[model samples]
Target: MGEIMGNFRRAINNTSLSRFRFYFQAASFLLLIYGGYLALNLGDQLPTFACIFSEPRGGSCYLFGLQHQMTTPWTSYLSGRGIGLLVGFLTFIAFFIVFNKAWCGFACPLGTIQDWLTALRARFKIRYANYAEPTFQRLKKIKYILLALLILIPMAIGNSFFGLPKLNHDFGVPFCMICPGRTILPLFSGDFSQLALDLSSKSKMILTALGLMVTGIFLSGSFIKKRFFCLFCPMSAFHYIFANAALLRLSKDAGKCSRCGNCYRACDVGIRAIADDLQHKNIVKDDCMLCGKCVEMCPEEGCLQVKFLGLPIYQSTAEGFFKRMQGRNNAK
Candidate 1:
């Protein structure tokens, strides 16, 4: 078993998995949007933000997006129908633990789109922006705030419907109302209907405008910054709250580390805690999407590793780093 594991780690570390991860992202993007029609043949859709749409979503139980998964199930508390909420919540947990934040890294259509934008910027040789340490630290709090609002607004709105059926038409799923993913992901399917302004009510108009504005910022910001929206993604906050349950993790070898800045520079989210915190061995941070960019870039043998169920699948090595760089230069 030890020999087999050692060989697996060596095989993984020799080649950059991020390059192959793109294949998974592209395939998942296709599957999420069109898999049901394309004969995936699953009885129910795997739960995801985009799968909660009305007619077009592929998921088994289509609620009002991920927000519905968060709210409607809890509504049983106020009303008498707790079963849907309880079942849906369990489904969410089941899908969540399989890979945890790896969803953000590998499968999320929004995150994939942002990565494509980063690639486009790189192709043009345009410099990407990185937040300074202090600014980045402060920005980390935004996701938590968004997470709170997403849950609170839905709970309030779900309850209000029982008490006052005519509350804000757009109140039930407040985060989805303004989530850029709602307006952005459907465009690939040749659906622009989501972009239409909701002028039904004064509340709807406000909600529509807010969603558009956030989408606009998302477009421009993602072009200039890597995973720009992820800095404030409520979904990311949700994942980290249950991160401990994930079997896969990023582990650090403090003694093997050399304080090299390459890992920090390579990180898309600008998480500096990877370098500064030598006190802890398991170095998963809340801001970390578990993308493994640091492990790919680090030039220290076994200094950083991608561990699956407490076993190493990949690790950093100086020789491997230089060999890949040299290969790239020669190809150029």
Candidate 2:
């Protein structure tokens, strides 16, 4: 028992956890696309940034339909009966609290695709862009705006919520009409049908054109910058609002930190706050997906760590960090 405990302690003491996340991302992405839903039925839950407006109204199904079952319950809840809504939300929360935004890190199909794009850029030695603070802060607002619109447009569709001004019924699932997920995610599943524009209705034609445009921007932006679409993901906004129950989180030991800024440089989202915030112990920023990149890059002992329910899983150490960093630099 002593030997077993010793080994487990040593294992948990090690840093450099990003490789595990990459493997998990690959496995989870495949499992989801191939019909694996955590029995919570949210196996298809939209990423942390999937539109919440999509929640009550339904019809914003992603490729592979992972969250379609999830949508049905919520949609029914909106109409009348509350049982499905209560059960669905509870069931989702039960599993969701375990990992929080980790769904963005290890399971989102579009995020996985962005990882592929980053890898492709790396393979070609292509330079990727990182935004400056001012621009990044400005870009951050876009998602909140998108989130608001995602809600308002769908609510408008229902039109008669206790006698409120109604938007057009033709605008059903408005966000879906322009979601890049609607246009791009389908291509991977051998569904080219989304590419066709329905000239049948003005709404259809306009939305189809918008989808194509957004899809183009998504592809180009992803190729140019890591996790580009994620910066504006309304789903991410939703997660931030209710993520207090999440068990998996990132924390920092300011006393042990060297202020190296390596974590910020390593972060895919370009959040400088991780390096700038010298006071807060909970280093997990709003933009942080708990992807472990910051933890992996941190070079100071116990400076950064990923914790599950407040227990440390792994912690930063100079030896492990330098070994991993050197290997990565050499690979470049």
Candidate 3:
């Protein structure tokens, strides 16, 4: 049994992470997109985009619930309604703590779609685009701004703020009003109603137009830039707020790293901290999806790792690195 276990570990360590992730993402994509046919409802507080717009979805995004919860009357906090909000928040935290940002990297239907586009681009021999350092630094903050708006706008709709008039009800769920996921994810399940422009109200018309425009950008941008939408995802920002409390984590052993730049190149979201941060042991940055790509690509033994509850689940190994390289060479 001991020998068998060792061999199994060796096999996993040497396998192609990209190939493994492709199959995993495919399964997750199906489960999230079509699992409702099996009556598999994970719930409405999932950290990832199990879009409600996609009928019979396995789950719903937490943002959808949060935005609505924020619309409750300010005085309701003293009533039983407040308990429901607390329970909902606790539930979201429970879900988020288990997998951490792996929800974004592994299970998000939208993220999987972006990955498929990236693969398609690769197949066509097209070069991918990258943000300039200055631009990346600036753009990454957009998610936080979006997160702030999603929270404050809903509150404003419920009650006046700073002596200002209450926002129009048509601005309901402001973030969702413009989210591209509502426009795109439904198409997988044969629903195209989101494609139409809403003329019922002026606000709806403007929101629908913006939603359509974002959907166009989502499709085109994701094709050219890996995980393009992730840079500005409010959900990503939300996850980062509680990242330190998650059980699953990415950590680095700076002492073991030779800094050959392999891990940085492997990062889909272009997180520079994974490669350059030598001072901190915990390396899961806000933009990191906990995708495990950095660990898989590192050539230095024990340099990078994915840990669950402080125990290493997967880590870089020189032997594994060499074996993977050999396998790639054989394939060619």
Candidate 4:
């Protein structure tokens, strides 16, 4: 078992093309587009598959129509329970535990869009500041606060402790409403207005505020960091909270590390894999999206791997653990 595991680790560290990762990512993007399309055109016809927030005021949609019920200002909103939300959330959790944010790396449409934008910026020789630097690292905490607000505000509104329902009425799934993925869905469907809701004068101010927030994300992506919106996303918050036990992870052979800083430089999240404690090397950070770029960029073979259920998968080598034992003996 140990021999097979070691060989498997070696293979992943050596290879560049990860088909499983790529396919899952492609599928995710396709699904988001399709779902958005349905939301825009077929929303009136299809039974709500899963809408966690509110009933489409316009039609008989059905997947998870509970969202419409929760939209009442006096009630706490629950938008993540609809069939689509359930499936998406479950799939995200399963992938997180199995691949440790691989969804963020490959499957997330939001991440994909951000990567595309980042690529464009890179083409122009522009790049954001590295998150590893002390000055920039503080920014990572912003997401946690955003996450807390998402949960707390809804609870408060539901409890009637505060008149937060007024806020909820203006913004449905306030956290998700501003999501870049949500924003992109409408654009992909050729109807940018689909994401917008009709509002009164008071609600219009709220819309303006939300619009500015989204605009800020776009501007930040263009001039600062790619996917700056991700820093404050509630979905990312949920992923970070639940992906702690992810099966596949970025492992390291610390002894072999030359500490050349290549992996850190290669990492989109700017995690210092080689320098961190071996126990901390699992790509387990809340910000880690598991894109496999670090694994692809590492120069030393057998130094990193995508561990599945704590076992190595995707790539493996013929040299078993016994070979390593023999090599050590011979060296001695």
Give all candidates' CA lDDT scores: 0.76, 0.69, 0.89, 0.53
Q: Cα RMSD (Å) per model? A: 3.2, 4.8, 1.2, 8.6
Worst lDDT 10-window in candidate 4 = 44-53
Per-residue lDDT for 176-210 in model 3, tens only?
Answer: 87888899888988999999999999989998999
User: What is the Cα root-mean-square deviation between model 2 and the actual structure?
Assistant: 4.8
Best-matching candidate per lDDT = 3
Off by over 4 Å in 2: 1-7, 12-16, 36-79, 160-165, 329-332
List the candidates' TM-scores in order: 0.89, 0.84, 0.97, 0.68
Whichever of 2 and 3 has more lDDT, that candidate is 3
TM-score attained by model 1:
0.89
lDDT of 2 by residue, 213-284 (tens): 898999999998999998888777767766776888788888887778998999999888788788988766
- Residue-level lDDT for 228 in candidate 4: 63
> CA lDDT of 310 in candidate 1?
87
Candidate 3, after superposition: displacement of residue 286 in Å?
A: 0.6
Ranked by lDDT, the better of candidates 3 and 4 is 3
